[model samples]
Target: MTTLFISDLHLSPNTQDITACFVQFMRNEAIHADALYVLGDLFEFWIGDEDRSEFALLIKNEFKTLVASGVPCFFTQGNRDFLVGQRFAKYTGVQLLGDETVIDIYGRKAVVLHGDTLCTQDTQYLEFRAKVHQPWLQWVFNKIPMFIKKKIVAKVQSGIRDEKEMKSLDIMDVTPSEVIRVMEAHQVDLMIHGHTHRPDVHTFEINNHPMTRIVLGDWYQQGSVLVVNDSNYDLQTRPFFNQSI
Candidate 1:
């Protein structure tokens, strides 16, 4: 059996085609996998678990169906969807994992994450990340009216888009030293994550020991999936049409 991994779908009402593609993937492919791991950014931005939007319902239903089929699903909070809470997990049946979690892949240990923490050079973004992740702050935000929360999220997303244009590519990408440090701390030579939107397999050495990092891609224009089995692993992209679902 194969274990499938994906990230950065950024599904939202505006991205119906991509959402349909994700639904099709859940029904056709994920149902047959031994397990599925979502590294994060599963949605454009998650306000809170109280979200009752049609789009959120559709995605949750897909996950519920996949999990009911006996394929375990795991999720890690992403930079965009860190507000995903227990209610979402309960409704979808996906186990929420920590930002960095270790798992066994066909007898080998591999660390999986959303990949934002690896970008240590992006100090400004990191500072923002730290503030938003505070439990007390999140609790306060969640208590506010849903409409106000939506406005805040919209403004933040807009700011992020503008900020990204000004930030250098190197600052946004993961730091090699941080990756090495994380891998060493976890005592795992293999790591899998998504956030930088650059999908590729990286191979390096740590004190002459071999190390590997696999980056998953965003699904803005196409779907990205990583398939792992006993023998090997492959990073693949699936293209879809823009027609109505």
Candidate 2:
């Protein structure tokens, strides 16, 4: 059996084409997988569990079906959807994992995370992350009225869009030193994460042992997936709407 990993779908109601692709993926590829790990950013934005959009409901129902089909599902919080709490977990039957969680896969140990924390060089965004990730702040945000919450989220998303335009590409990506440091601490042979939206399989050596880092891509123009079994690991992609890479 193969285990699957994906992230950065960034699904939203407006992106019906991508949503259809995701639905097809769940119904086809995922139904037969041994397990599925969503690194994070499954949705474009997730307001607390108390509030959900029509598309969000659709996605949740799909997850429910996927889990019922016998494939275990796991999720971690992302920069965009950190408010995925207990209610969402119950609705989809997905096991919520911490930002950095390690698990044994098929025989080898691997570390998985949403991958934003590695971008330590982005000082401003790091500061913002620290503030929003505080328990007190998250609780307060959740307590706000749904309408107010939407406005706040929209504003923040807009601000992020503008901010990204001003930042250099390197600053927005992971810091290599941080990646090695975190991997060393975990003592893992493989690391899987998605946040940079740059999909690739990278090889490195840590303590004289071979290590691999698999970066998952965003589901903007295409669908990206990593498949792993007892013997081999493969990265694959398909056109989202048939244009090109």
Candidate 3:
């Protein structure tokens, strides 16, 4: 059996093609896999479980169907969808994973995460993340009216987009030191994550131990996936147009 990994779909009403693609993936690809791992950014923005859109319900039902087929779905919260909680998990039948989770991929121990913490050079973003991720702040935000929450998220997203335009690419990408530290702390040679939207595999040695990092790409213009089985792993993508039903 094989396991599939995907991230950064950013699914939303505007991205209907990607949503269709994801449903196709669930039906044709995920059903055949041993497990499915969504690293992060599964949605453009998830305000809260109570603010479910029609599109959100559609996706949730699809996830429920997939799980009912006996394929387990595992989700790690992303910067955009950190509010995913027990209600969402119950509806989708997905197991919520911490940002940093370790699992055995076959016989190899692999560390999986959303990967935002590795961008240490993005101090501004990191500072904001620290505050937003605090339990007290999240609790307060969750208590706000849904409409107000929507406005807040929209404004923050817009600001982030504008801010990103002024930042250097190097500042946004993962820091080498942080990556090494995380991998070593997890005691794993293979690390998988998504956030920066740069999909690639890097092989290096850390503390004399060979290590591999696999980055998952965003599903903006295309679909990206990583499939791992007993003997090999493959990274592949399909165009959004081709993905449409």
Candidate 4:
């Protein structure tokens, strides 16, 4: 059996086509996998676990179905969906992972994360991430009514879009030094993550040891999946086609 990984779906009410693609993936591909790991941005934005919108319920049902079929699923919160809490996990039966986690891949150790923290040059985003990840701030934000929270999220997203346009590509991408540091710190040769949206396999040396970094692509144009087993791994992209769901 092969372990599957995906990230940056950014599923939302506006992207019904992408959502359908994801639903099909869950039903057809994920059910047969050994395990599934969703790296981040499962949703465009997750306001709170209390979100019971139709879109949220649809995604939850898909995860529930996948888990019920005997395949284990895991999730790591992305910059957009960091508010996903225990309530969401309970509903979906998906285990939530920490920002940085290490696991055995077939036999070798591999580190998995959402990958935003590796962009050390993006000081603005890093600062914002620090502020938003505060437990006290999240507790207060969660107490707000859903309607108000939605407005706040919209305003924040708008600001983010404007800021992103002003930033350079290099600033937004992960720092090579940071990547080497993280891999060395974790003592892992393989690292998998999604956030940069630049999907490709990167090879280099860390203290004379070979290292591999796999970046998962966003699901804006196509569905991206990484299939891994004992022998090797394949990164694939599935185009969205018009099909009855």
Alpha-carbon RMSD, candidate 1: 0.8
Model 2 per-residue lDDT at 219: 93
Deviation (Å) of 158 in candidate 2: 0.7
lDDT of 3 by residue, 1-245 (tens): 89999999998888878988888888888999999999989999988888767887888888899999999999999988988889999888999999799999999999999999899999998899888889998889989998999899899989989999999999999999999999989889999999999999999997687999999989988899999998878889966654443
lDDT of 1 by residue, 1-245 (tens): 99999999998998988987898889889999999999999999998999898878888899999999999999999999999989999998999999899999999999999999999999999999999999999999999999999999999999999999999999999999999989999999999999999999999899999999999999988999999999999999988866665
Q: For residue 169, what is the lDDT in candidate 2?
A: 93
> Which candidate leads the pack in lDDT?
1
Give the C-alpha miss distance for residue 186 in model 3, angstroms: 1.2
| Model 2 regions more than 4 Å off | 241-245
Itemize residue pairs with steric clashes in candidate 1. Answer: none
TM-score of each: 0.98, 0.96, 0.96, 0.98
Q: What C-alpha lDDT values do all the predictions have?
A: 0.95, 0.90, 0.91, 0.94
TM-score-superior candidate, 1 or 3: 1
- When summed lDDT is taken over every stretch of 10 residues in candidate 4, the lowest stretch is 236-245
The local lDDT score (0 to 100) that residue 157 gets in candidate 1 is 95
TM-score between model 3 and native: 0.96
How well does candidate 3 score on lDDT at residue 7? 95
By TM-score, the candidates rank as: 1, 4, 3, 2
